[model samples]
Target chain A: MDRLLVVRCPDLLDEDEDGTALRSFVEVVDAVEAYCPWITAVRPGLCSLPARGPARYFGGEDALIRSIVGATSDITPVEVGVADGLFAAVLAARRGLVVPPGGTPDFLAPLPVGILGNPGLAELLARLGIRTLGDFAALPASHVLGRFGADGVTCHRVAGGRSGELAELRQPLARRRVDEQRGGGRPGGAPRRATVVDEPGFWGGVGDTDVRAGRSLAAVQDLLGPDGVVTARLQGGRGPAQRARFVTWNAREPQEDSTLGAPWPGQIPPPAPVVVHPTPLRAELVDARGEPVRVSGRCLLATAPGRLSVEEAPWAEVTAWAGPWPSDERWWSRSRRKSARMQAVAGAEAYLLLVERGRWWVEATYG
Target chain B: MFVASPDRRDVDAPPPGPSPRRSLDRERDLASLAVLAERTRPVSSSQTRLLPVVPPLADLLPDGGLRRGSTVVVTGLAGGGPEGSGGGISVALALLAAASGTGSWCALVGLPGLGAVAAHDLGIDLARSAVVPRPGAAWAEVTAVLIEGVDLVMLCPPFPPRPAMARRLVARARERRSVLVVVPGRAGWPEHPDLHLGVSDMRWDGAGTGEGYLSGRRMTVTATGRRSAARPRHRHLWLPSATGAVAEDATGTGTAG
Candidate 1:
């Protein structure tokens, strides 16, 4: 008997966040190995490594499968199937076989047409009302080849338990979960399994809320592919709605754009809605005065660094400089400051400033 | 000077022939002759020189390349001879074509009558070029502006300039690296130019009895001031010949005629 262990992962997409789901699957494989000390050999995925050695080491087909299934139950919920060939083993596993041996053909006979890799073949078979693998196997190979080409002949062979190929298993380095014991063991010296406890205590120091707007800026950067631009408007405070605008350039894609209020400890600002667009050559930024501010950086820095500014705070580094013109205030209001403004192009946006008291101060930045 | 005839009887009869009108007419003729002499005074070779159309011809000139931006004083004779020829339009076109082809923008100031369209007909694309017209004697201002940013400037002074002013403008042109082609009307230009071209005997291309439809009259081009190792060669160019004109033994040296 060939004891074939088929492990199926129910959720693949959830693994993208981190390797949690894959780690869970690895734990189950470790348990099986622990129980069956005489299990001969173990393989990871069936499609990757040669199965000949394991098949021969277990002595015969029937005994190998029984030993594998018996050990597997100690670990996780897995269906064990055994067969003479690779296709038979896989089909038997999918049919929910607990202990299948020499029943490979019967196991595969009534399986759906979808099991074959080719959808066109499955559709054609379904249209002909050939609901079982037996019906496909019954067709003459030459006639099927004449109608559907060489793939049809291969499918016909697979439908029967006569596929000459063995399962190719890809073996990964044996990973023992923290809770599982390692194989090839001397019992007394076994390492203690480390369990990852997902408790609130695990996340103790790391705050739950992101108080600074850096998180939002990071999101926006991701959405804009490399060489993108962003223009933003920031408005806050209780008094007559102060507004600031800024433009940033050369942003990377899949970014998140958000805004947060001043970074006060223990207070997290809600992330503003992110707006994304294809990359632009330049962007603009503004402040409550609707003027642009300049941003400067060291040229040696290859990537764009994120920027955040406080309302009414002055920025000293000037990247670009413009003006010495006096604004006419009598045309508008006597209270307005008739000063010279400088425009600065900064990372992710532009900053504006008004020169006063022999010092430069930020007026606006592109949002 | 009196031409006394051997027959003295006629002397006494003519001695009585002193009509006031004739004397007056003679005085008027002498005054007119003095005026004509002043108008047609031949400028000394040292006073001004005509440069050649191209720089390579500068070596062929006594002075290098029309004094490098000095005014070229062209003098036209009342009739006949090299000075009598009128090819200012052709000369202007050729100079412009050569300068602009070498990536220099030329400005023609003050001569609005110098049709850019005619320049186009002569193979100069003036559209990509500029022409500014100023009234009165603003050649100095125009010349200053041309030398500032432009590569070549053709300034037609409202009134004939003094010899010193012309020399100064030429010097300025050199400093500015501009080619200043001053029309002959300006006075007191430099004599030594890179190239001096004298044109004469211009005739219509197709006229008179000709053996073929395209046959044209021949013209004479003389190179008198060329200083290059190559001896200045003059040629008679048939305007409508299949090969146009031949010069310097079959080399076609003076085709611009």
Candidate 2:
């Protein structure tokens, strides 16, 4: 998950028929973008950017947040906060507090379940005596999935602080409104090539396959809606999921300086995993004594890993393993995390596993 | 500064006039240029119409490249579990690398959480590839549509495709002159492909009991197909060598039968 800094203007959240609030929100985005180039307009009045780079540039997160607040205060009263994921970051912005790294779960535990934005689920949980996120997080995942379906499982993960995002947090249509304000012609800019007026077989012209592909992909959009088809663009980040961003195939534009050539200090070496779970899978690692293995505060393993099970599947012997690469990210900021990653080869498969808060999760697979 | 340099330059220079022309006329020159352009096009030859394959995996195909209208099935474990699993996704991705790099468009259907970095490491042109991670119940229809648009389409059916559906897709690929690469993970393909590649015996070379990082992996790839490639051929390869490109595993000898 990304360590994000969210800027929220409470008064500008709702749009007026006269378009007054949206115009002010655009000003807020422009002011924030002056400090950081990667600021994303999550919605009409909310925006976020990865906190690591900007924090490093302007002394620290506190200084950076202060500078942004100072810049945007003229346009609209702005609140800024940094946290691990977008959902927590938004909540942090609301309270004007920075949630410390590896502290999101603790931060979310005391909040009411209604904060999840799903009133129906909250009302149901309220009846079941699960009023707070902490109580909801305590339910066994299997029971949650059986009762709530996939959406429930997702909410369960977010409430437990194991995951950082919820599908309802951002409205894509609102983001498009912000994009249109930035003068990129139409919302997503033009398609990469001029597929409409194609001059096939001529130099510098679109090919026959490209035109055919555009038409077919448009057909898919008709079948599965606009968000169905996507293309991946490479970006610099530590985790596999963070390194790439998937955008609607038609709306994708060439982003500059998104190559892997940029130096990322703590990234895992090459031969990157072929599968990065969008949501990390739960795992249990135990020693021969059947005792759960742990990583100490000093970054040392409690015992040699003997067996491992993912999603409560049958245990497989841990044949070979690598470092518990300590990731002390954003240490300068209050949102610092003390997680570690390891490469474990069990049987015929290899997995990039992450351990945080004494819980293990399968982050990626080298298949 | 020096005025005599003009005469000195003339000693080594040819008289300026109309540029020399070839003895061949304009019509002949145009014909020769046309032949050069046709031969230099990315396709192997006009008759066979083959797409290029990476050098390490060339021998796995009967035509030394992907035939324009052929179906290839790649089988391996699908998901990760406590029991360990190796997906045939890497091989399927490797097949797309060479063709897409040479300006061919490709599409991936029904594979989720694609490790984009790994695809880039294997030399795939991400700009030219379209990925439909979750096609749901419409995976077959999605694959059929992609076959008409892209030069190569890699399909991992989200469900066990019915025999009729699989046959229809295979027939569609044949008719459209597209290369269909299927990574039939758990949802097996019912129709027989022109070429079948299976991945097995995966072993990691580095990282033993909290030691070095993952440097490389050795795996056995068996290729069997119809007609010219009726006999099975086994080859050992580093699916992802230390730098993340396919390479021949020198330690083991391949057996062809």
Candidate 3:
């Protein structure tokens, strides 16, 4: 059995963006392949691909088409039409038909002359009182040849359910993959190993690494595929000496890296994953100058999926004195929230705390 | 006592009627005064109503601007007659421009080769325009659809309509309050129009030696039929400076019915 399927976007003309439509078409085609291996998508403005290989692999033509149709409907709106030739299949699909084999000639015979697309031919055929394909096929070959030349002969052949010359399809090339190494060591004294994968068609692969470091991201991209994402964390260091951890999407574990003052030139390796939001803190402090004062403190917060939050302390005590300085902050617009902060200075250090989601968390300290 | 009696007798004798010439003189004076007043008042000037053409031509046509829902038959001269130079583009533009001014959408029914770009150059916004080609045996059906919604419908027939179809379309236009502008190959149409205008070429000054613009030309617009009689004054007009072509008063002799 021979079967044909036509896939079309009903509102293709009305769509404003071409990229969106192309993406949608690709997704639908991918969905179709999930069930049926015999399916081939017909790209607009290109020659059709032969279904013979897929048809044989899938057992039979009918099962192949049915599987394809079922899978396609799961993702997008699609219609299927089956016929002997591509031309007949497209027309049948447009007219919403599922024609049986050897039925093309009889089916096309009664269609209007206008549907033929050639106005001159339609007018001439109408003048001769020939209204249907059956009538045109019944005429003597020589007479039709005399009237319409080569085109008439071709039309006659097409009407008689004969195949014409088909075009050859070409295959696409394969993709290459690349891997890159991270810093000399791991961050936070944690055991870590990070590798970066940069390859064409590799999507959504940002392993673990602190991406905020000045030049670590640039180093990672240089080492891995030219387009690599790094997520990382920093620990056990102050300011510039802070330890950074990172990972590439393909990497197994986060890699710890260190940047003393500035990042090293050349290929910057990927780092380890650093928690985007840090825990909030509150503290009481005494002034180093020996004056009795109350100070509240706050720190930045981090959350999953790489988001940051800020919270301030509500109250704090300093040098045996306590005071309430409530904090109210909203970062809904910028996706960050922190308001008034209370700081307490105790001896030589200042401690900070934050209240988030109605619970207080130890935030940070400054020495 | 004797002196008083003589005065009373004189008073009774003097009770007499006035002269007949006096009454005649009064009636003659009133008649001449009426005639003088009638002669001094200028003849009542007729009121000119706007004729409905396409929306753009509203300003060009005398008031009574294209009767809403009436048909304007646009006739083109055969061969290269003096009137047929621009094809039908000029008249079509004029109508479309007028319709556009009123914020009305115009549909070109059965005219396939109408150059939308050229139409735009002539100041017809095709963005707000729709063209239906051939329209097949359902031309009337399509026309009815446009007539019901569109402000103006322009039709260039593949074949002249039979009387019945023409009458039906005209009635439909009236019912829908749409102005139907028919571009006719020849002058005659079976049905009479509310106003008939025959357009012919007119002479004008050439473009300025240095200036970029072409000086306006004068056109001989002959207005006939019953509608024209009320405002029968006809004169040459300079094509106005506006891109849509408004008619400006020109130095010409007037012919009034």
Q: Please tell me which predicted candidate would have the highest lDDT against the true structure.
A: 2
lDDT of each residue in A1-367, candidate 1, tens digit only: 2334454433421334455544555555555445333231223322111233554677754455566556545544455455555566555555545334556667668777677666898899889888678888777654664455434555666676545222122121222222232334447754423111212212231111111111222222222221122332333331111222233422112112335355433111111101111111122334434354333221111222223232332322222323323323221124654344333333223233334323344443221
Full ranking by lDDT: 2, 3, 1
Q: What lDDT score is found at residue B207 in candidate 3?
A: 25
- What clash pairs does model 2 have? A101-A335, A101-A336
Model 1 TM-score is 0.27
Better of 2 and 3 by lDDT: 2
Candidate topping TM-score: 2
Off by over 4 Å in 3: A1-67, A70-79, A82-97, A100-367, B1-56, B59-69, B74-89, B98-118, B126-169, B172-178, B183-185, B198-201, B207-214, B220-257
> Relative to the true structure, how large is the alpha-carbon lDDT of every model?
0.40, 0.78, 0.42
For model 3, residues B1-257, the per-residue Cα lDDT tens digits are: 11234433433322233766755655565465455556543342110112234432443344436656767665432231111222343455455664444334566665533433224434454434555544555455456555655666777665667778778778877876667777654333566654445445443332221112223345545454455333533434443223325354445535321
By DockQ, the better pick of 1 and 2 is 2
Candidate 2 retains true contacts at a fraction of 0.67
Q: Over the stretch B83-186, how does candidate 1's per-residue lDDT look in tens digits?
A: 11134323444445543443344556555333322243333334224444433454554455445445556655666666676666667677755567655533
Clashes per candidate, residues 3 or more apart or on different chains: 78, 2, 73
**Residue A364 CA error for candidate 2 (Å)?**
0.5
Chain A TM-score for each of the predictions:
0.35, 0.52, 0.38
Model 2 lDDT at residue B251: 80
What lDDT score goes with residue B189 in model 3? 53
